[model samples]
Target chain A: MTGYLNIILRLTIWFLLTADLSWANIVIGVGVTILLPRGVTNVGLLKDWLRTLGEVAVAIPQAYKEAFEIMLYPHREETVVLERVKPRRTPSLIFLDIFLITFTPKTIVQRYHSRGWYEVHYIQRRETP
Target chain B: MINILSYTCIILGLVFWYWGTWPLLGRRSVLYKLHGLSVADTLGSMAIVVGLLLRIPHEWPLLVLALISLSIWNTVLGYVLAYCVTDDGTHDVGQEVGHGG
Candidate 1:
């Protein structure tokens, strides 16, 4: 019940976003949503994903603000440092981390280092673990 | 009023588009160049689509698809490009990354 509701809600949002209320597109979206793999029926994962997305949304303005600051202070010099980070996660999670980090302009994955460590280049290296 | 907001979004999106491209001219490494290009392109393009969405609310379906595709496609392409450019082989991959590079 919840899963179907989730599907309907998501498809509705998709419809609104697309602004294409055509019956064919709606049907296709519904079919695709229905055919998606149902590995884990945990609602908590959806919540977590939404929360993370919100955090990312908040980070964008901050990124733009930093970009503006960089433009204003050309001599400030952003230090691009390389760091080895071994994320204690599964392969899928590690891929997600890489995707997220690379998607953001502040940090990017250069390559995989030795012993499961990812060598990442960051504009400003944060000190928090 | 809505038109004003839409224009603002479009102009801001253009600024981001230009800003992203500006770094490409710098004598930076390939990673840095790809970073600027992909990030700016994704955000700027999405912003433009959103602005268009506001301007023409009836065309939301296609615009929304564009926005969704922008996020997924841009991220995946960036990962693929980075992976291809990274020439250090971990195990035995038959010289994949190096060959791609």
Candidate 2:
């Protein structure tokens, strides 16, 4: 729809603050998105999208809490990343780590249950010895 | 040249995050699922990093610090996300490449 086109155009302008082929590519991307809108665009992409939107509307508080935990203490976590590394239970800790990492800016949950050792990649080496 | 690339990346990333992903997941998607980051995550955040790298003044330590944290998290989140998307006993029911809705 025309509404989508207008939004893309504005984004193009934002990118154009610096002049280069990068900007040109960005503009082209915007134009393409406008011309070929898909997925849950236009509030009518699918029934699933609507259901998802409603669910997300309800999940804000939990998400916010998780974000808070990750941000407040980003230093190396005290908990063992893998059970083999330290003999603690994992389900709860791994779940908490995942939620926390997702919201916080510096950390992320990389992989779980790989070759019998839980693994993750950190953006920084704070936790690594 | 850097400025241009950075700005272009920022715009592209923002579009996918705000317009592209927002409609499907709404605000919840922003929460960072950590399972499968989606192409949007890396593309959008890298755009941000490139854009910020171009404009930031050396005196603005606070801004740089914040942006640094953001970029790191984006990468971590995306790597986790990709794992989750392709992990065992699960399947992407909707919105993957080369598939119909």
- TM-scores for the candidates: 0.65, 0.29
True interface contacts retained by model 1: 0.30
**What TM-score does each prediction get for chain A alone?**
0.51, 0.25
Model 2 chain A poorest ten-residue lDDT run = A77-86
Pairs that collide, model 1? A18-B60, A18-B61, A19-B60, A19-B61, A20-B61
**Stretch of 10 with least lDDT, candidate 1 chain B:** B92-101
Inter-residue clash pairs, candidate 2 = B9-B47, B13-B44, B35-B81, B35-B84, B36-B81, B37-B81
lDDT per residue for candidate 2 within B12-88, as digits (tens), equals 66764553244345332322333224324543454565577677654244444544445445655565554655445
lDDT of 2 by residue, A1-129 (tens): 333324543454444433335767777766765666454323223344344335434543454343334435433322122222223423433343344444333334335664444433333225344
Runs off by more than 4 Å, candidate 2: A1-111, A114-129, B1-3, B18-23, B26-38, B59-64, B74-101
Candidate 2: deviation at residue A73, Å? 39
Candidate 1 on B1-101: residue-level lDDT in tens?
A: 99999998899789878977888888866666665666478777877888999999976667777777786578778767766766664322111221110
